[model samples]
Target chain A: MSPSLSWIDPGELKETLSRIGISVDGPPAPPPSFRPEPSEDQPSPPPTPNTEASPPPPHFEPVISVAERIDRFARWLEQLTHGAPMSIADPEGLLIEGRGLPEPLALASVALDRALRPIRGLLGTHQVGSVTLEIDGGRLVQTIWVVTPIGRVALGIMVERPLEPGRVELVREGLRRVFDW
Target chain B: MFGLTIASQKGGVGKTTVALNLSYAMARRGWRTLLVDTDPAGAIGLSLTKKLSQAPGLADHLYQHTPIAGLIVETKLKGLGILPTGKIPADESERFTNGLADGAVLKAIQTAAQGRYDVVVYDTPSGFVGATLGAMRASRYVVSPVQAEPIAARGVMRIFEVIGALRAKGHPVELLGILLTMLHTKTQSSLAVAEDLWKTLPGNLLFEATVPRDPAFLEASAAGVPVGLLRRRPPPIAMVFDQLAAELEARLAPDAKDVANEPIALVD
Candidate 1:
């Protein structure tokens, strides 16, 4: 059985924030609408118009194109992994973006992603978080499959050493941020 | 002014929701509050008023030296104000993030808000780098909303590590506590995660109030209003924020007397 949850009391929590220099004294009186109920004898004032206007609906065109996003993602990945060889491709083995990836290795990475797609489908899973492969040359190839607003794409990186767990988490977060997954 | 940042390492953890409602709650409690949106994507603007998309905001102020005072968008809520992310060009987004890394923009905001606001709440983008890091560095306190899931639980350690590093460097940023959000009471996995977190984390590190997973939040978001304003009478879930606010007030000012506790004469 999992342990039941318990948290700090209000006094202790207050002490924590106070020690950090947060002011305990409240601000001045709020707006009229936010004020407490009026006394029985006090006549209610006429209701004032709400000055806050409804903002226009978002009709702005997409500022960043798919190609630009891919390019930015590639650049961000390269910087994140310290210029490690990286490639991004569709499931059909089409190279959408890459940096320092030899043509053959890039193609191979996409092929690997392509091959895994059917396996994932057969297993009733639409996405694979990540896969790590050790090639013959002692290099590690890490691939993260992400489903973005555009489509499903595979991000692969080649590093001489195994990527640290924290780094991998960062990479995953970067993927989410850049790709809007 | 008190600087509080709502941050999380993982996405979809209800950071924006917490920031939005908590700031509004604080404002309703008579605290002049400024809600600053630090996400390059302008999430706060998008979530609330859509017209702010074209307004100059934090990014504009950071990059173009725009005055922070003029950038503030007043709301119908008297004590509540907002500093939207403004328009971030696609190509200049990286530059904007890089600009925030130095913490200058946040410092400027705090300086500008000093006399104007009683508290400043920052809603940061996901991940601990760039703008989030800048906000953390500039804030005196941070509250992380941890989604009730195993993956989100794993991400809590990263927040601690980052806060630890910040304090080690003498930045004086405090981790107020971890708030459990999006809890699904019916889901055993979610309950288990909450239980595990309560058991694993120190008592003072976790908040007592937990935000449940309610369809009302979705409804509120669709309507672009905080849960407190969802209906003529807000749904029951909206009261959780008031509870959370009371808890926060108690924590922020432990010695402050509670006027609500005072007795009222039967006839006067």
Candidate 2:
């Protein structure tokens, strides 16, 4: 038995997304970032760090609230990287936030977080380190472990192509500002 | 009884997913449906309410003379039952191979299913091989799944040819439609393939439902439930299958005068 009905073409989905201002190429860019665009004439301000002797004890009690903050940080990283994806996960390997990274990259970042957790225990207070993970498809992911008062914060920056050292340092600086570490 | 086989000549065409979820949808609509897993590689058991035991299944019913009724397991779905492709002994695979080639096994299965189910859906394996032939032989209609790819679209021709040969041989089975599956509209290539298929295929031979590629299926598979039965709100993909099921029911209504004709007489 067969019925006469018009089937929606798959291309229609692309058209629908386009109507909603979403790109078929990838996830839509973060609404042009809620933060104000820096004026061209004004020099960019350096990240400001709290100079207090003891930073407020890492607030770990409400994991939900901390997770929300992590989302904001992830969005900020998205803006900072000009839409380059980033994966952020807690020390326990739970994905705190992520954008643009492929599924395999996100899952791999979780594993990386778990792997780097043990190493964080042996590091000194001021030590922050980055490791490069070679993945399939000849891609590379640069993951940084920033020591926070609460625990280690793992962030992964997906590298689509070769980049300069200054660009990598800017990503690290963004992480430091976002996590306040 | 109306028996529909969800089959394909290519792998990864979403036959099992469609068959299993369609059964659930049919059951929800108050149709007493039975989903039979003819494909040895099918993960139908994993998506069912309970893990199907490694007991004798259709193979035993065919080769060892186990009662088909005994092998039919009730699922969590109210009006649905599952006859799993249970653990077939390594030795029995060869025996069944010969049985399928001769069409004896399928004829027996058809006879047993007669008058018992409102709809019996069979999930067949990849390719137009032994298992697929057995399913095709027993069904009144075939739903050929074609993945949204050029090669997969070409495979749809083989299914039509099989249905044609069966029709010429006096078997009354008909091709219901070609279901496009695993379609990712976000990708240009996926869109190109789908558009090409739509233009090339006869409009009536394409179901109105297009299953989008979604991670929700994986979530449901992992949770051992139909996409519609996922714990949270059912995803859009789930709704797509539900609509497809409803449309199929309308097309294959039991009271639709054409269905009054008896199936080809079971030889056995």
Interface RMSD of each: 14.6, 19.4
Poorly placed runs, candidate 2 (over 4 Å): A1-181, B90-94, B101-103, B253-268
Report the lDDT of model 1 for residue B214.
87
Error of 2 at B61 (Å): 0.8
What is the C-alpha lDDT profile of model 2 across B1-268, one tens digit per residue?
A: 6668898765455677899888898889777888887755334874553457364577777667888888888877777888887775433443554456445565566567666667778887555667778777777788877777544554445565677677668777777777878877776566666766665454556776887778888788767788998866787778888888867866674663233345877685
Q: Could you tell me which residue pairs clash in candidate 2?
A: none
Give each model's whole-structure lDDT: 0.72, 0.64
Each candidate's clash count: 2, 0
Tens-place lDDT digits, model 2, residues A1-181: 1111122233653454334232346432221122234479998777666768657766554322232344455556656555455666555443444443433465576576666556766773334456777776666787776655545667777765634567666656665565562
Local distance difference test, candidate 2? 0.64
**CAPRI-style docking class of model 1 based on DockQ:** incorrect
Q: Where is model 2 chain A poorest over a 10-residue stretch in terms of lDDT?
A: A1-10
Query: What is residue B18's positional error in candidate 2, in angstroms?
Result: 0.6
The DockQ for candidate 1, computed on C-alphas, is 0.04
